[model samples]
Target: MRLLTVLYDRGAAQLIRAWRRSLHFRVVSVTLVSSTLLVVTFSWLLASQITAAQVGSRLTEAQKQLEQGRSYLEPQFRDRGDAADPGLNGFLRYATALLVPADPTAYYVLLEPTNKDFLKAVKPQSPQIEDTRAAQDAVPADLRQTIEHSRKSAYQYVRADPDGRGERPFIVVGTTVNSAMGQYSLFYLYPLDEQVDSASSVRTTVFVAGLALVLLLALLSALITHLVVGPVRIAARTAQRLSAGLLDQRMEVRGEDDLAALATSFNQMAANLQRQINRLEEMSRLQRRFTSDVSHELRTPLTTVRMAADMLFANREDFDPLAARSAELLQAELDRFEDLLTDLLEISRYDAGFAVLDTEAVDLVPIVNRVVERLRPLADRANVELRTVVPDEPVIAEVDPRRIERVLRNLVGNAVEHGEARPVVVTLADGDGAAAVTVRDHGIGLNTGEDKLVFNRFWRADPSRARQTGGTGLGLSISLEDARLHGGWLEAWGAPQLGAQFRLTVPLRAGDRLLSSPLPLVPEDAEPRLGPIPPDEPSRGVRHAS
Candidate 1:
């Protein structure tokens, strides 16, 4: 039973899904249901009216025949006066030939009334009826009571064995006649076999016609809906292919109609998109080339300036205080410029898809510690405390040590820079074929939509805020690329005044997929301050940006 219920539920779900998804199916189904209801309703009304008319005609005919029989007998009783007439038993034998004659589809009953005063000619006689006892019993008592003390005729329908056979339909009419011999009670019965047969045939015809009409309506609706839905389905498929990078894909316009206009519009939209995409592609290609070329071109001059700046700094004590300050400032700016050049070149390599991984299994514990130690001075200078939460056992994963170290340095450095004189927590945990690192800082956190923009090239959350820490603005972007290279995730979560958490999740085996992170992207305390996390971008390894 449970299995049957499951199968039924599954079938219902599939039907519902199809109904929701297919316009043609829905239109045809609605037509079929509505037409079936209408056909059934009208057919029933028509069949019932026809049956009532047939029955009414039959009743009228029976009433006329009853009147004829009454007219024929009333004069006979009047002419046979009280002194001349025999008893009702003799009268029955006399009138039996004319009134109670054999009938194939009817029965007759001649019953004596309770008041014998009416039968003045002789003693009362027992009731006599033709055919089986079932026919006599077929007369409803209420119908007989209506005729007992009245001259008017009354009629009713009943079902019984009229011919010593099984029960069949019948029409029983009761009446009374007045004459000089006295009033006599009489009844006539008629079977409705012909009327029943006619009504049944009409019902069968209506059913068959209704069924055909319903089927025809369904087919017409299906064909009509298809003419509209077919082109829409083709347009949908074409849109899908266009989105999948087939920019050349376009719908074929067949005629000068609304559907053809839709196809024309779709093709025009595709053409416009393809043109814009090609222009953007060309621009991006040039931009990458310019950056790579400029970075390489500046390296020579930068090296020559570096040597001179170093010598001038070494001999700065020999000069005055102003000269030494100039030398120090020059050296610092040069270092910053060199760092920017290096970052730009690295970005160019990533853009060119030339960056390759040099992966190996390495302990992440030492790497985390190493990054913490390197950034300790910077954190201390900013009046921020650096903290680390790591397991005693070494965290191991297959990854490039150099790239991972660079990512850790970038994350730790950013945390300290933005810690706002508060503690920076760097946590490491490993589990379930994956490892994760979370760097959290209590500071003026990101605003709405900043998390997604955080990893965008050269994006700044608060550009007006003095960046004394000298970020090149490509740190997070590079880190995201590195994570992606390892088939891992670098997700960010932040809320205004609730601080921020950056989670790095990597699979234990390089090139293997990462299902989940060992740590959450939002800190426990910050969850209430945030709304729902943004949706994951599966195309990239990064999941949600909260």
Candidate 2:
């Protein structure tokens, strides 16, 4: 049943799509179907009326002839009486002879008394009715009963195949006649061959005419639909080209009609859109240039200030306590400022398409282990546990090690800062032409709708929270760019109070498309580590430094 429903739904959807795609097809199909139904219904009703009229007229004529034959035979019967002047056989022969017509349009049957054995046989008027028994049995039992018991006439329609000819419709009129020969049932059979032929001819003409009308209507519908849908189709194509950056694309206006007006309006809209897009492109270019220049200009001063701060910090012990403390704060702020400037410069280079990849074959397991070891001290200071799960075998990939290492440092540092004294799990795996690394932190997870925004430059998840670790807010954004440059993917998934997971997937061979990742974004062991950790319970999966 489900399969049938699916098939039915698919068929219906396809039909609807076809109808929507072609206006001409829709118009023609509807016209043909409706016209056919109308024509068929009219033809059927007309044929029924015509057949009824013809049969009624034939029945009336048969009744009149039957009455006339009775009028002519009654006197003869009365004159002959019970004396048996002309014997029963002679009377039957004379009666049949009088009723039988030369044209053979009608045949007569004479049924004698049931008790009489001598002339209890059917006598048909024409030789065409070869089977006398069949002719006698043609009269329906109910009709014959009515005729035998009453003086009133009764008639019915029946099928007859006289002389071995194909069956044709006939009317049998029956009535009882009391005479000297005894009580007899007389029936007159009338063949309606002419009426039948006329009806068939009418039906044939109606059917042909209906078919012709349907075809003509279909053709007319097609012509009208084409005239209307043709210009619309052209305009649709023009709109598609315009959206594809063909700013000059426009529809030809042929006449002063609705379609021509539509074309004019469409062209005007395209022109306006092209102007707006050009202006926006100019503005974007200027903004990128300005940002690049500013970043380049700041680097010299930042380097000079960094050198001075390094000198002062190297001699901080010789100065007063307050002075040394001040120098240390200045040096720390300068470092953060320099890092921000560098991130901005990197972003500008990316926008200007100046950044290039320096890729090489490298095992990712050692890189991940190194990043964890380097960040282990920071994690300890922040009271966050760092855990690593790497395959025993080296997971090799072609990548720019510097860029990947920077991304990993940013991710691990961010996790450690926000981990809320909880364990942060970092996992790596390689399979199916790709390698994946996932950093999962059980912390105050991302709020609703923050997953996508987290990758946006300078977009912070919480602006009010104090910074435990300095973040320029361009780390995830730059990481996403680096992943894309390697023809890979970087995605984040998170829910409130459920922690966040950042997954980076890269192809084993640089520039090779990565179809799937070996590891899932949501960790397999997530449920067990979701709640608060017990104070006395030793951390189970921690891998320190190594």
Candidate 3:
């Protein structure tokens, strides 16, 4: 039973593997089935011929023996004209002695009409000199009458001793003889058992030959199928490698068949794909350089205008109320424009694969404190309280302090804008191989399921919200990009009427990895636990505040 189970498992595994890796199974199955049908057809024809020939030979042999039996009995009756009892017995003994050795299982019986009275029939057994009345109905009446009518010779096949206890099969050949007492019938019985044995042996031989032929055909079919499907297997493997980003993969084109043409086509396709990729890469580099140049060019003029505006605003008391207000608005607008340019430039750099990280061991606690201090004035004006939580020891990380500081300041400012006069919390902590800073605000935080979209460019949870402080909506987007450049995590968690949480997790050392964030981004006061965020929402990007 265990072996049977193992066989079943092996068969199932083989089928699965063949389905996955081999195309020859289908080919082999079709070939074997066809071969099996042909072999069966041929075997059946041969079996029919063999059976026919055996039966014909048996019939021919039976005819020859019947002719010989009649010839031998003709002379015996002619010499014994009207002779009676014991002389006929002597004649029968002589005939039996002549036919015994070649086929010992032959029998002869002689019957006199009416037993010298010609009124009643008599029968005799072996070694009995006088005729007896036993076995009078041993033969069928039709056959007995035919024997009586054949005063010359007749032959028939019948059951031996039909009315006796056991019925055996034999051929009966008969002739009638006239004697001194009356006319008598002489019959000989020959067994047909040898012919049956010959027929059975012929069938057995044919069956064995058929089995061998079928097995041979199956083996040949398998080999042929394997050869035909081998190239297809190679092509499938090459296609798989090409999909896995191996642009140089090529198939061996050895023949002039369709498979070889397919291989040639695959190689050409790979070459074309590689060329397109290279062209796109070159175009991307040129675009990045153009964006950077424009950003630099704009920065110089914007800086000059900013310094001039500050100088003009310093003496604003002499100007009219309209002019003074105009000056302040110009400065604010210029600041927002500059922030947008900077983010666009950074994004171009990232797209061109030019962004690089400058790593150093710096404590995150001081960074968070500085960001909170910078945003404290804005928080107070907005009637929002700002709180900071820092660990005792230095929660050190390898990061660009300048970029990291800019990111924290953006998160804090964003919280203050939406805090709705509620307290905002900035928490920092150390974790295994990483450090995290979370900024939380108890405000009408965001639209339902818009936490991830908060970091996308120019995204707004509320479009009607005023940008009084002059913010370019690219701060969180740029921050997220910066965090990704350092292989860190910058994610948000928020809900409607609850609060918003933005967590920035950075590695402790250069190239250090993070399994998970130490602080959770989603606030505790959200209504639903988790919900799907729509990607096509109107407020689906970063909101950068300058």
Candidate 2 vs candidate 3: the lDDT winner is 2
**Once superposed on the true structure, which residue ranges of model 3 sit more than 4 Å away at CA?**
1-283, 527-546
Off by over 4 Å in 2: 1-23, 70-83, 87-104, 114-143, 149-151, 161-167, 179-182, 528-546
| lDDT of each residue in 429-527, candidate 1, tens digit only | 999899999999999988877887889988888889877578899999899998888888888877779888888888899877777777877787765
Task: Output the TM-score of candidate 1.
Answer: 0.87
For residues 206-241, could you state the per-residue lDDT of candidate 2 as single tens digits?
899989998998899899889899999999899889
Global CA lDDT computed for model 3 = 0.71
Check candidate 2 and list the clashing pairs.
none
RMSD of each: 4.8, 6.6, 10.7
Q: What alpha-carbon RMSD in Å does predicted model 3 have with respect to the real structure?
A: 10.7
Position 185, candidate 3: lDDT: 63
State the C-alpha lDDT per candidate. 0.81, 0.81, 0.71
Error of 3 at 456 (Å): 3.0
Model 3, span 341-404: residue lDDT tens: 9788888777777788877888888889988998899988999999998998988788999889
Of candidates 2 and 1, the better by TM-score: 1
- Which window of 10 residues has the lowest lDDT sum in candidate 2? 537-546
Worst 10 residues of 1 by lDDT: 117-126
